[model samples]
Target: MRILQTDPDDARFAAWCGVWAASQRADRPDELPRPAREHVALGRRLVEPGGSMAGTHRAAVAGDAVVGALRLLLPVRDNTAVAYVDLAVHPDARRRGVGSALLEEAGRIAAAAGRTAMVAEVDEPVPDPPGRAFARHHGWTCDLQESRRDLALPVDEDRLSALETEARAAGEDYEVLTWRDRTPDALAEDRALLGRRMSTDAPSGDVPVEEEHWDVARIREDEAAHLARGRTVLTGGAVRDGRLVAYSELHVPLEEPERAHQGATLVLREHRGHRLGARVKVAVLRELAATLPQVRRISTYNAESNRPMVAVNEALGFRRSGGLSTWSRRI
Candidate 1:
């Protein structure tokens, strides 16, 4: 079987990969975005900056038909740090050698760039037997556990109000804000400060939080990109004395047109005990309900060991969906 690599923007390769992905997902019990096209679009945007040490892409055409594929995201922080990998195999190609070939290629690409590690993630509610087996066979070790949670739709107003009151009484402050096309200049600055404290408070494995900071220009560009796809980003922050301490972002997946996903929530180190993390999250949910009335469900995830976050999500009426274990191997 011959292997071919293509830029995510290559139309012919993308169409072939999309066709294969559609056929495979036809039998699944749960819903997921069609793989190949979604990944291709992701890859294109990630690789646009010039002199980016990392590579961005999608791959297909192992041997005969386009049976399986993978997307590789190079790191933005450490030049030598191997980046994220996203893979999918056509249903009919399961148990075949296609996946193995693709993974071997991934290792080669990493090794060529002197990278020692690669990271991957999968959503809950998806069966991952083949993926689990591939990692094991390749000597990749499972290192971290992430838990996914889903918030009920048409949020219970009385229950949400009670939670907010309890959090406030505990010395925390909460506010939810929504914007049209751009995040306010002041909020963007707060995001930078909040980003600096994430590693200290959030669950992180051997991977270091790359010190790459986001400025207004960067955040603005990202917002425009999201809006271009018909999605909306709403920010919820916890503040004291006009200073932003903790924040969370909720994203509506407009392309899919049905579900909304909680992006990322963080609380600074000095503000941990007051339940600001949970308060900000629930606040985001309330904002989404008010703004986008058509959303069906909202989902978010945290490391399985993050009992604090888990407890807060549960308090806000989000149920445990399932867990995903992140696996990695050195090239």
Candidate 2:
């Protein structure tokens, strides 16, 4: 097998996406399958504005066909010693060394870039799925476990109203506000602060993610990238003393109108305990239901150990759909 670096627009990239889509279906059947265009858009974003990392794509070719693909993400500003690698092997090509060959090439690329460790995630409905088994066999240790949850849209109105009332009572000192697609100029700075807080306040378990630095420019760049991919962003926040103290965002992808994604819900440490998390989340869900009636499901992931966040989600009618296991190994 030979590994060749390829562009995302290459004709062979579609074959790589086929492998990825098949793998996702086998691993997490309940989730929406990403199309080839989404993968292409992701590739473009990885190398574009406000991206803190550089991405490399490699395809494993055996004889005349592509059987596997690997993407290596190397941080450009922080965690420079680490590389994130994702590998997908065609179902028909498994057990033929396709995955191993791709992983080996990924290792070489990471080492050449001075990376000391590599990380990847495996999705499983249970703890001992084939993907986890493969990662263990390859000497990668499970570093973190995230529970993926989905909320069916148009939630029971009475239950939702009760929860909203409870949250409002708890956050009597705070007021909720919302916007679509872009951050309002009045709240842009505070929104940036909350975005940065999201990285530092959330539970990371054993994952080695660094605190992300955010500002108004970075926020606008992120919004632009989402728009470029034909996705709409909805944001809701809790304000106290004219400053954003808690926030949540929902992303609706144009390619899949029936599905949405809960991006982040964060309440500043000092503002925690007032049910602001639940308030912001419920506010966004209500707005989404009213504005984007076609969205039937919204998915979000939380570290299993994040009990407070998990409780908030459960209170908002989210159910456990699957789990993600992150594995890491030293190069």
Which of the numbered candidates is closest to the native, going by highest TM-score?
2
Cα lDDT computed for each candidate against the true fold: 0.68, 0.85
Q: Model 1 over residues 184-276: C-alpha lDDT tens digits? A: 777778777676556456676654235554555556666766675567787788778767778888887666746777776888877779878
Pairs clashing in candidate 1? none
Q: Pairs clashing in candidate 2?
A: none
Structural RMSD, model 1: 2.9
Tell me how far the alpha carbon of residue 289 in candidate 2 is from the true structure, in angstroms, after superposition.
0.5
Which parts of model 1 have CA positions greater than 4 angstroms off? 16-20, 23-28, 34-37, 50-54, 62-64, 124-128, 172-176, 206-212, 228-230
Query: Which digits, one per residue and each the tens of the lDDT, describe model 2 over residues 136-250?
Result: 8899988888998999988889888998998898879898988998898888998888888887777777677777778898788778878877889999989989888888999
How close is every model to the real structure, measured as TM-score?
A: 0.87, 0.94
CA RMSD of all predictions: 2.9, 1.7
